[model samples]
Every structure is written in C-alpha cells, then in structure tokens.
Target: MRTSRDAPTRRIRAAVVGTGAIAAGSHLPALAALAAEGGLEVVAAVDVDTGAVQRFCADGGVPHGYTDLGRMLAEQRPDLVCICTPPTLHREQTVAALRAGAWVWCEKPPVPSLADFDAVEAEEGQEDDGGPYASIVFQHRFGSGARHVRRLIADGALGRPLVAHCQTTWYRDAAYYAVPWRGRWDTEGGGPAMGHGIHQTDLLLDLLGPWSEVRAMAGRLVHDVQTEDVSTALVRFGGGALATVVNSVLSPDEVSRIRIDCERATVELTHLYGHGNDNWRITPAPGVPAGEAAAWRDFGPDVPSSHLAQLRELVASMRAGQRPRSSGADGRTSLELVTALYKSAFTDTTVRAGDIGPGDPFYTALHGGAPGWAPAPATYEEASA
Candidate 1:
C-alpha cells in the first residue's frame, strides 16, 4: 500500500546533488526527458564546486545551483532529490533530503558502510505515512531484460535455479585511482566489488533471491590503494543454489555477465555497462517443449537499463507514497552481500546472511576497525600466519 500527502499523481519538484559526470551525463538527461512529459520539474542542483555547479545548471537549464545542500533543500523544497555524489557523502546528503521531506534516488555504493546506510534509513518516513525514503540507484535491475528474467524465475517458468555465475571484470589504471577517492576504503568504499561489480551482482541477487552464505578471497594484487583490486567468492543461495562471483579491476577484457543454470532452462546475460533485450539468451533443457523455450525468449520490449529507467519508477513511488523497489531492505541487501564478501575475504571465514550486526566489526566498517582505514587491516597472509 502507498500513502502520500498529495494526489496520486502530481507534478514534483526535483533537485540534483553533485554536478559531476554522472549528473551531467546520465541524470540530467533523464530528468529533462521526464520533465518534458510533465512528471517533475528540475528546480535545483547542488555541488561544492561553484563554477562546476553553475556551469552544470546553465547547461542543463536547471533554475537554481547551490553549493550547500541544506540551502538547496530550504530554497527549493523539492519533492525528489537525486543524489549523484560519492559514497562518503551519501548518508549525510540522503538524511538531509529526507529530513527536508523529499524522496531520494542516490547513486550506487549508497553509503560508505552498513552503519551509514542504517543512519540514513533511520531518517526516512514510514511508507504508510507518505515517506521521504532513500532509494539506491540500482538502475541495472530496471532493464526490461532483467525484469523479464525475474518474472520467469519467480513464476517457476525457468525451474529451480541450481547453479549461477556472476562476474564484473573491468580495468582501472593509476590515473583512475589518482582521483583520491577512487580506490580508498574511506571514500570509494571498496574495490570493484563495491564500486563496479555491485550492479551486476545486485542484478544477480535480484534474480536468485536470498543468499545464505559466502566464502570469499580478496587481495591487493595490482592496485597500491588501501582496498583489494580483485576478489572472488563462492555463494550459497537459500534455495540450495551454488554460485561463483568475481569482482576485478585488473582484467584486460572487460565485461559484466551473469549466467544461471536452472532445472529446466539456462539463462545468460552478457553486457558491459547496460543491456537490451538482445543481450539476454535462454535455452530450455532437452525434452522441454520448443514452444515453451520460444515463449521464454519473448521479452516484450527493449528498455535498456539507465538512470532514467529507475528514476521513472522512483518518481511514481514518491507520488504514490509507496515503498519503491531498491529502497530500505531491498537496497540494503546488496550492501550486506558486499560487506559479507569483504568480511569473508578478510577473515577467511564463511560469512552468513544476518551474521553482521551492531557488535560485529564488519557491521560498522568493511575493513573492520571503523568506517575508515584507521587501525589498518592485517594482510591476509599476516592473518593466516
């Protein structure tokens, strides 16, 4: 059920925080397209870079540009706040937006850690009370291909998922890490696992449902940064499925892929950043009706996953005062998996779902001391020794 203070469908005012590449490249265009359709107005944008924010607003034709988020919220009182900032700033920015009575659509790696995620979650209004909730931008899940696959998996059309593989293998060099926040525990959160591969794995979990346990390994194989550049894990899903996951920033050939072998059929999606219907393939097991396999391949239309795809659904959820997909528990689930992956990697233990809590070192910090790299984590070898 959804509850809202206003009519079921009304024009909403929106503000964009962080006028960086993501804001200029992805979010602004989506907002503009939606604005033209009379869904919302892009009233303001916020960023610490004065010149950049001004140029962004001028180029995007947003009415107001402010460096201070508090100022923007006070001035615009937007119904929706689209946060395109770094992981570190997400918690504070989202909490502020929710307190100002706005729904949030934040960029991925939503907060630095689970504790930060929980802090932002605390400030959100109840869905039954016409909330101002914060939703992580997991745009990958919004694509038509994923939606179609999820429907098939849920309906048992694909039969029980027995085996799966999820991998996010990409390359990032020294220049990319030179940004200061790109490869650090305190700022960017983690390596490709939290930063790059999260989208693909989140989509994996979206299809496979709950994961029961994970045993993982991560190392700083190439990067000189505080976090690992590559990691691998074996996961057990609640329904008795086993999977392997790899997150790496050292691969020469780049790809984002997920393949699931179910009891009756096999499904695969291969794409780099975003995917369309053509990227997906389904093969029914032998003896299954050929017509059934054809029906499984029928994805209605091609909606490539994008910031726009998620923003559209988020806006509708805000207007209807409903708990949108990828918010609250749904949003937190992927973060938990990442955290568990890290915990399992660092501690050499098989971490289970619901294992990390207030007292758990991993609950508040991925590196297990505090949110940042404070006490300094022992090397995996040192821990083993």
Candidate 2:
C-alpha cells in the first residue's frame, strides 16, 4: 500500500505520448490543470509526428517535446507516463513505460485483443522490484454522478441490481472519418463501439459487475468506416443481472444516459456533452413505503464534476502505496466484453466471457484477422437513400 509520504511534493514529473484528439482534448487539459496547481509537471511530450508534437506543445504551453519514445524515456525518465496513443499501440507503449520504471496511466481501449493484453500482463509479471504501478484511463468513472451511483449500490441503498440500460448516441461526421485511423479496423481497432461506447461500457461494468455472456450485432449504418457505426448487445452479468447497451455514432443528436432498475427502486441519469452532473433524475417505484423512499432519496450528497478527480485519486494511491481504484485488471474486464461482442458478431451466436480466454482460438485469431466489415459510402444519401 502507498503512503502519503511517498507522494511527490515538488511536482510529479510526467510525460505524455501521442498528440491526437484525446491527448489534446482530455489528457492535456487535465495535466495542465495539475501543473497550474503545482501538483504535476509535464516534463516531456512525444508523438511519431514531430510537427504535431511541437505544435501541440506550442499551443499547450509545454516546453519539452520529442518524436522518439525511446530517447525521451531514456533521457527524461519521468515518474509518470500518460499514453494517449492509438488502441493498438497501448500495450506496447504501456509495457515500454512500465519496464522503464515509470507508472503508466494509459487511455482505452487498452488493446485490440485479449492476446495482446496477455503479453502486457506477462511483461508486468517479470518486474521483481516494485516501483511504478500501471493503470488504465477510464475517466468516466470519476464523474460525480457515476461515483455516487456506485456508492449507493455498494451501500445496498438501491437494493438488488436487476437490470440496466445504457445508451451512447454521438455524432461523427464524414470529415471525422477522413483521418487515416479514424474508423479503420486494423489501426483504430473498432468504430463507435470500441471508441465512444467503451466509455459508457466501462462505467457499466464498473457499476454493476463482470458480464458472463454477450450477444451482439454490429453494422456500418452511417459512417464510411471499416467497423460498426451502430451496435447493440444483450449482456448477462455474473449474478444473473441483465443489461442492454445501445451505441451509435450515426445518431442525429448526441445524448448519453443510463437507467438502472433495482429490486426496490430505479435510478436514471442523463448527461449531454459538456453537461456533466448538472442534469440527473431519480425515480422510485410507486406504492413504496414513504420511509424507504425517503431513505433512498436522502442516501447521499450530490457528487462533484471533474475529470481530474480520478487522476488525483491515482496520485494519492501511489503516495499511499495502494492500488488505484481502477487497476489494469479491472480495465481489462471492459475490454474483454468488447472482444466478446466482436466475436459474437462474427460468429452470429452468443459468446460466453470465459470462452474468450487468451489461449482460445477466437481470441488468437483476432490479432491478425481482418474485421468482416466495410466502410459506408462518402454520402449517406448516396449509400442509404
């Protein structure tokens, strides 16, 4: 377990890899916030494209930037590394950082397949001296409303969890796919399901539990992409809890919502882009005893809204010699569900989570196998209409 004395006081030295959308939007801003408070420092930023890294640093007020990861790792030796690279590159970069004695907080989806995750796990196992711990970035878990809901479930205030419904509807214009890795199966992994939906999916797995089985269908409904623009799945949790996931990048408007139905009551949350916890609704079943209903209503205080909250927690854990709230193993569970969905879509059958292990043939085939999907046409009218 980590202790408070272990926390770095003179600013935690940090490095960032990749200069893409996520790096620019989420990770950079959060790290900048920490730097402003003197809690963290951005020591080095790296990208395969030097110009991109330099431009990002110029705009973000960062001083050091590099194109080669090895050179940066050898020279800077940052205490923490933030990997904002592509999905396929996560495993390799994470292992590289960890082996170099840097704690890694990488973006998701962690890896394209379970096989790759096994390789990362193997690398982690070889480390005898415990210095830097590794974790995955599932920032949605830090959202105030999500954390409150998790606490309520833990306290048994919601009673037995029976069912959950999650909807992730976000728009991705044709120009969004114009980028080389935007919607490609081999490069970006999967489309909306793996990219956007993975956030909510990770939250679902975090709040509920590991899924036991999954049956899913995916298709290129709108975007000109090699993966699904829209997908749906029916999931069965370990304790027989049922859930449904609806993810789409083709929706006309964007909205993210989750509804959990418990034995005693139900809770619903609706948060639009840029509107975190400002909008939420909780409704209990009718005809319930007033006392229980009131207790449920007064169970807790409102949660705060901040993406940096989890990062703070991670730093605290490192100081206290404890594991972060969401460890690499926990992060892998959501990815496992994603892999299972892809496998189910390809086989046209239900897939059990345990059946898709590292040694499974389906799991191994996913590494080099081409996605059985094609991109939609440039114009929706030309393709669908």
Candidate 3:
C-alpha cells in the first residue's frame, strides 16, 4: 500500500444504533463513504427490532448485526458509535457507548431535556484521554455559505448585527405522527420547536452568539400530537441583537429561512432541511460598497449542508486527536436554547440563560413535569386522504 511520511492512521472501528429513517437516509450513507475511503469500517449494527437490524446490516454492508446495544459494544468494541436513534434513546445509547470507550456521533435533539443532556455530556472524558467525546450532527453550520457569512461578520464586513428572524415552517399531517415517538413530550421532547425547526434555530444560534433572554408561546394548533405543532419566540442576544423565531408544521409551501439585519447588509438564507450556495442572499445597506455586497454572495467553494460534511470533519478531528466541532459543549448551546424556549412558552414569561438549571422543573422536562396535551381524536387515513 502507498503510504505518506507519517504512518497512516488505522481504520476506526464503528457501530450504529437504530436502523431507522435517519440512519438509512443520512448517517448510513455518510458512514459508507468514509468506509470506502479507508477511514473507518461499519463493524456492527444494533436495533430493538431484529428484522430491522438484519435488513440494515445487509443493505448497508455492516459486518455484524445485533439486537442488543450492549452486546454489540462489548463484542465489536468499536472506536466510534453512531447514535441514530430517537431523542429519548440518545442519552442512554450515548452514555453506554462512551463508557465502552467509543466516541459518539449523535443525531440532533441529542437528548429530550437539558438535565439528560448534561448527564450524557458528563460521561465524556477529558481531552488528554483521547476520549469518548460526543459530536452532535448540526450540519447546517458546516456549509460554505454559512462559513463565508461567519467570516464576513468576523471581519466587520456585516458590522454589528441588529435584528434577525428565523422561520422553519413545514407541513406534517396527522399521518406523520402515526409513528409512536413522533410528537409526545416524553418521547420527542417538544413538537416542531424541538424536532423540526431545531435545525434552523440551531443554525441561527450558531451565527448569533449567546442569547440573553426569550419570551415565547407554543400551541397544539393543528396536529393531534401531544406537543405544539406551532410556536414562536422573541429572543434577545447578549450582543444586543433581537431575533424573532417561528416554528410550525402547518405551512404547505414549507421553507426554512433566517434573515439577519446588520449595520452593513441584510443577510438571508432560505431552504428546507439543507442548503447550498443558491439558498443564500445578501443585500447591502445603502451606504455600503457594491463590491462588498458582491463579495458576500461569492462563497468560493461549494459545500452543501449535509450529514456527510459533518461526518468528514468528525473523522478528521478524531484522527487529529481533537474533540470534533459540535462537541457536547457546542451542542448544549442549542439544547439550552430549546429548553429555555419551552420554559418561556409554557410559563408565559421571560426565560433567561442559566434559568433552566438543575433544580428547575424545565431542566428535566420541557413541559415542566405537567401532563402533556392529550392527542386529539384524528385518524391517519382521514388526514392523509
């Protein structure tokens, strides 16, 4: 085999938990690409459903299949594990993998609550240990457009950000919630706010730094789900920027959009789920130069936002013996924002950073331990047809 001056790193052993939609659609494909390039091997697959595991392993070319996560962890002893399960299962599966001496790549909504998320983060070891770190898949922040915009802000091209708006308005009929874990507070955390819109909102938070406070409201408007199908919030950033956030699963012409008004220009990104350069636009403030406006839209290389982009970075970080981007701490920012939004919405009051800590009811449950809204009477066929 051809080799570089430095010895090539061994292929990292990897396992996957949950043989579901996200695993098939995103994570599995990304892992397969990495495996093909000789960075890692998909050593094991685990799921509660035996049939699902069998099919996933066969289809994905994973070497071993197991029904029990513990068994897979022990037998395969993978260096990395992908927790592609539901939000509720993420904490348990991640902690187990960490304890088993594997770094974890977890899907978004890493845990249902801040209390649980902190617990999982605690399982990660210090940097010197070459540890058992966990990286959350917040892929939207990895795209070239986002990277270019971030550089613009850093270079004072956009000037101080003044105001912003974020929207994740998508449609999901009652049939979509037929899946057992789809909309319940206990299993899925919150509704569109937690599950669907989280991607855009996380990207919003990624661009704007820390937030100071939020006032929000949520309602179980259309779907019969236990959580809110639509919600809105007004946020105050520590940097003095104010943003309005809206999340809904009711719009037919679904779109994820975020617009930021800065001193020099107005920057906007619009797309559903993921984005490429075409989704971004910049309008300069009246006094700003046209050249700067043109430069804003000229993101050099094209990199679309996707799981594969993040996975490549995660694998590279592992090889460099560094904690990956969107590590536990980085992910907690978005989770904390979610928790605070729930606290503000449910209570009809302002919620600040550090307000939803250990003893706060919102820390453990998004609904503050209150009983979730009972699912309204609705049938999947009736809604779908």
lDDT for each of the candidates?
A: 0.89, 0.76, 0.86
What TM-score does each of the candidates earn? 0.95, 0.88, 0.93
Off by over 4 Å in 3: 1-8, 370-385
Using lDDT as the measure, the top candidate is: 1
Arranged by TM-score, best first: 1, 3, 2
Error of 3 at 136 (Å): 1.2
Looking at model 2, report the run of 10 residues with the lowest lDDT sum.
367-376
Better of 2 and 3 by lDDT: 3
Model 2 lDDT per residue over 162-218, tens place = 999988998889998998887876678777778888877888888887789999888
lDDT for model 3 comes to 0.86
Tens-place lDDT digits, model 3, residues 151-263: 88767889999999999999998789999988887788888888988888888888988899999988887787778889999999999999999999999999999999999
lDDT (tens digit, per residue) of candidate 1 on 153-224: 999998999999999999989899999788877888888999999999899999999999999998888878
After superposing candidate 2 on the true structure, give the runs of residues whose Cα lies further than 4 Å from its correct spot: 1-10, 125-131, 287-306, 364-371, 374-385
Q: What C-alpha lDDT, on a 0 to 100 scale, does residue 228 get in candidate 3? A: 87
Off by over 4 Å in 1: 1-4, 370-385
Q: Least lDDT summed over 10 consecutive residues: which range in candidate 3?
A: 1-10
